[model samples]
Target: MNYRSSELLEKAKYYCNELSKHHILSKYWYELALVLKGSTARGNSDQYSDIDLVFFCDKNILDRIVKDYYDEGLISREDGIFLPLPEWIGHYNLESYDDLIGYFKEKNYPQIWEYTNIIILHDELNRFSGIVEEYNNYVFQDMITDIKEKYLSLQLTLDWLRHPLKRGDELSVILHCSKIIRLICQLSYLIDEKTYPHDKWLFYYLKQTEFGNRNENKIKELGKNIINNSIPLQVDKELDEYSQYVLAESIITDLKNQIQLKYGNEPWLDEWYSFV
Candidate 1:
């Protein structure tokens, strides 16, 4: 842990310790497990970032605490301390190990990634620690299949949009550009073996990674221009008379080539262009 992480962890520890003293939480205090998650645990947090914590305890106890404490706003901003209160507080049941296993089996990689990336603050019986271990050990072959399907679907959509774009449909052209941005971001995460962060952190994560950092500005500018229903002048100049869209098709095609070169060709790629 770096200085920031250590600082965040200390704050979380203090908050959890105070929270454990609540009448509703006191009974399960010793048994409860605490974990630091999100950007803080991932070591990517900054001054503007907020800490996220998860507490694992009995389902019944958690339910009661949710009703009597969290729902009641007992843990609120009224208390001023070194750290802002947890941005998110998640409660998992220690007894319901099956749910965690089910998330992994169902290829819910985001949730699994959340658990695996956590920093354990407390785990009296090692229940939460064991779940983290399980997440780390789980195979993700199914996740790769899901990503490939998404890539293929987006590729097909881009192909279909070409006709409308050639007919001077601005909406179709914009949609095409937007989907290209999405596909590139998705492919970057797939190649990195990382879960795609939620939209709030999507661009941040993209620019922070090695592969994405190179095209980060291009992706952002192109995506913004597309959303605004316009194409970049440079991109428009690159579009050949035979091409359907005002924006350069080579942008997306080049990204596809990079994915193929880096990860090797997928069988779906051949099928993807077959319909085009």
Candidate 2:
């Protein structure tokens, strides 16, 4: 659980900066870049939003330094709750800029966005200032990959729904609907060209999208009809299932069109079929 803090963010930066100056704790670490990330850097700190310090040093040594600060009564190891003036520090580290870029290649675009959204607590030489375009290219490619994977998954789920729909198995159909809804949310993030602000904040972000803004009511109505069978008995059950079936098919058709329109020129990653 993240606790909301009005003033804790600034305080965490000041103290950590001072700590990095100390030789006993910082050692050779001060030569590397120190970044403040996560909620605090993003300006959305709650009580549990521990100061996420990404130290660009040896990963093993980063843990030891965080432990050293914990021993000094400057920062707490646990969530900064119940303690007075707690700078709950959570630490992550990368060895160098190359190591950081390696992380970009491995993560989802949304997560890669999080890594790039950082506050430089200590970087005397400004080593990280030039990574903006490099990261942006990585994010764009990652999103394309994510969209392709989602398109494939959506196709599979639509195919899976056929059995449940034919059997009039309401429970199985609703369960499949839930899975599709999750995919829709994920796909919407890519289509809308918005970084996923994480699941807890999904609804907050979703409403801001043009697609979600317009279709919110229909999505909710369809959700209720599928999940709870809330429509009156006068509403035919078979008709309801058929409606869901059409919606799934429509989603697939629409998403394929969106993909082609947005990324038609992107070279295929690999050719699965050829006249050999």
TM values, all candidates: 0.71, 0.65
Tens digit of per-residue lDDT, candidate 2, span 1-276: 123433645666776766566664567654567676777777767656666665564445555655665677756672221222233455443345666766566655565556666777777656555554466565655567777677667767767877777776777888887777667666777876666656655555567765567556655555665644564222334533576767766655665666667767433312211211
Model 2 TM-score on a 0 to 1 scale: 0.65
| Cα displacement (Å) at residue 192, model 1 | 3.0
Candidate 1 lDDT, tens digit per residue, 1-276? 667766776777777777677576687777778777887788866776566766776566555555565456654432221223545432222223455667677766567756777788778898777765666555456555766766776677666665654565667766777667676776677666666665566666786555587778667666655534354223223235423343435555656676677668876665776633
- For each candidate, what is the lDDT? 0.63, 0.61
- Indicate the residue-level lDDT of 214 in model 1: 74
Summed backbone clashes in each candidate are 0, 5
- The local lDDT score (0 to 100) that residue 33 gets in candidate 2 is 74
Candidate 2 residue runs with Cα over 4 Å from true position:
1-6, 21-24, 45-50, 58-99, 142-146, 164-175, 192-194, 207-209, 219-226, 229-254, 260-276
Residue 157 lDDT in candidate 1: 66
